[model samples]
Target: MYNLLLKEVRLGVNPFFFVLPLITGALMLVPGWLYFIVPLYFCMITIPNIFGGYKSQNDLMFTSMLPVNKKNVVQAKVLLIVLLEVLHVVTAMIYGKISLSLYPHLHYIFFKPTPGFWGLTLVMLALFNLFFISMYFKTAYKYGAATLVASTVAVLFAVEAEWLGIQNQFVSDLFKGSGSTDGLTHYSILFTGVLIFAAFTFIAYRIAYQRFKKVEV
Candidate 1:
């Protein structure tokens, strides 16, 4: 299992992806931008490229030649995906803090780059992985439909949330309003979102494992 994971790190994922967080996370520094879309773009660009490389490399066929089983292959790949997602979120958070420092009084038409906002980003990514990874691993080749459906759902979540934030003052205040008392509630929502993302990834891995087991190569 360790060897397979190393293979995934060394060969499965592109070296370019390692630095992509730095690139995409910079978007958080853009003042008054829709910050939620930074992580979404990370998913949109990286995931498809990762799987596209897999198909072009005939990675499934090549990996099947090795000693590892399908479950471990799936597990290692999913683990890599999770790691990348974490990288994206953490880097974006740092830039978000910098954004706050630079523009302390900036008003937002959409959600602020708060911990709660990242919590919501995690939920969006969870929906994306629930659809993208599970469906992509079903064949280990085709990812277009999976990517489209997953990306659409994630994008729509952000767009609609922004719409709600704009149209509803309560929602806007909930996301962007200043309230010292609501910090606890904000963190609680963040924690719950993390838990939900973990659950979703677990289920996605299990389903992908079973699905990949049946693929010929």
Candidate 2:
């Protein structure tokens, strides 16, 4: 399982995508910019590119030739996706810190990233990953349509959530009112979001394993 994961990480993911977190993270320095958009863009570009490329290259055929089980293959792919998401969030956090240090005055415009944002971002990414992994594996050989649909759906949901004032309620309060980290009820939401993401990711893994197991290649 570990070897299969390493293989996928080494062969499937582009290095450029890895650095994207850092690039997005640096956007925190921009005055009056929405920092959340950085991570959203990270998800938009990376997930589709990696999974879509795997399907385009017929990666299952080559991978099946190796000794790994279909379950491990699915697990490895999901693990890599999770790892990438973690990388993006951590890098963005670090960049947010640096941005504040460099321009203290601009800090007032940008609320310090709290646990609430992290929790919400996790939910967002997990929701997208569930759709992306499930759809991509359904037709592993033809990723173009699946990738487009999944990516579009994820982006639209995120955009709509922001536009509808769902994602911003906490942030808005933090910036406009006396919302403190201690006062926010993010831990419960964060815990719940983590559990939901884990459940959905597990479902996605199972779907991938089943689909890949039936593929002739």
Candidate 3:
């Protein structure tokens, strides 16, 4: 499982992905900026390309030739996806810190990506991963259409959510405010988000396993 995960990471995750957070982090210096959009952008641009490439390259066929179970292969792919998400979030957080330090007077309208925001991001990504993995594997290797559809739906949902938040006062408040890094609510939300992400990820893994099991390649 570990070896499979490493292979996926090497093949799918790349330096461009790592640089994305850093580039977006720099944008945080702009006052009242919506930093959360950074992660969303990362998802929209990269997830489809990476996963779609995997399908086009017949990654499953190559991996299946090895002495690994289909379930483990699926699990490894999911794990690699989760790891990439983590990398994105952590790098953004570090960038947030640097941005704040450089511009102390900057006023952020949205929650400055506290623990709660990260939790929210995790939940969003987990939901996306579940859909992307489940749908892509059903075709047994045709990711282009699946990826395009999934990415479109995910981007539209995110845009609509942001639009609604802008128009609704209560919804806007949910994402507003800034505070010190120490807080119980922040930690609680972070933990809860992690659990939710784990649950959804496990669900995705099961779906992938069942779909991949019947794949002829």
Candidate 4:
């Protein structure tokens, strides 16, 4: 499992992707900007390009021939995806903290980079994984449709969440107003998002594993 995961990190994924989080995370430094786009970059750019690499390299066929079961192949691949997603979010959160300190008095028109906001980001990516993983392993090679559908769902969620932060007074207070700074409220939201993320990703993995078992490759 470790070696397969290493193969994913070393040979399967490009070196550039490792640096991408830093570039995208820097966007958090932009004062009072719509910060959701920071994590969305993973869904938009990272997943497609990385999975495209897998397809072009014939990763499914190559790995299947290496004496490993379909389960480990799927597990390593999914683990790599989760790792990248977490890296993106954690780096962005650091930048988010810096952004807050940089402009302590800045008024945000969009959701602030609070724990609750990061929580929502986790849920957004969870939804992406649920759609993308389950659909991708239908063939375990072609990823275009999976990436398209999943990314669309993620974007829609971000849009709706942001809209709620704007249009709904309670949500506004919770995410942007005084409630934003309340540790209990924001942390609770973050915790719930974490649970949802774990559950959704696990479900995605199970579904993808079952689908991949039937694939000829």
Largest lDDT belongs to which candidate?
4
**Residue lDDT tens for model 2, 62-181:** 988998777787788889988988898888867766765676544344344556556666777777777778877775666566656666765676566455443476655653234634
Per-residue error (Å), model 2, residue 171: 7.2
126 Cα displacement, candidate 1 (Å):
0.4
RMSD per candidate (Å) reads 1.3, 3.1, 2.8, 0.7
Which lDDT tens digits does candidate 4 get at residues 124-166?
9999999999999999999999999999999999999999989
Model 1, range 1-217, lDDT digits (tens) per residue? Answer: 8888888889988898989899999998888898888998766899889888988998878889998888888888888889899999999999998988998998887788887887888999898889888998888789889999989989998888889888987778878887412778778878988998999989988889889888986
Clashing pairs in 1: none
| Model 1, global lDDT | 0.86
List runs of model 1 lying over 4 Å from the truth: none
Candidate 3, backbone clash total: 0
Q: Cα miss at 113, model 3 (Å)?
A: 2.4
RMSD of 4: 0.7
Better of 3 and 4 by TM-score: 4
For all candidates, the clash counts are 0, 0, 0, 0
**Lowest lDDT 10-residue stretch of candidate 1:** 177-186
The lDDT of model 2 is 0.71
Clashing pairs in 4: none
Give the range where candidate 3 is weakest over 10 consecutive residues by summed lDDT. Answer: 173-182
**Selected candidate, larger lDDT, 2 vs 3:** 3
Order of candidate numbers by TM-score, starting with the best: 4, 1, 3, 2
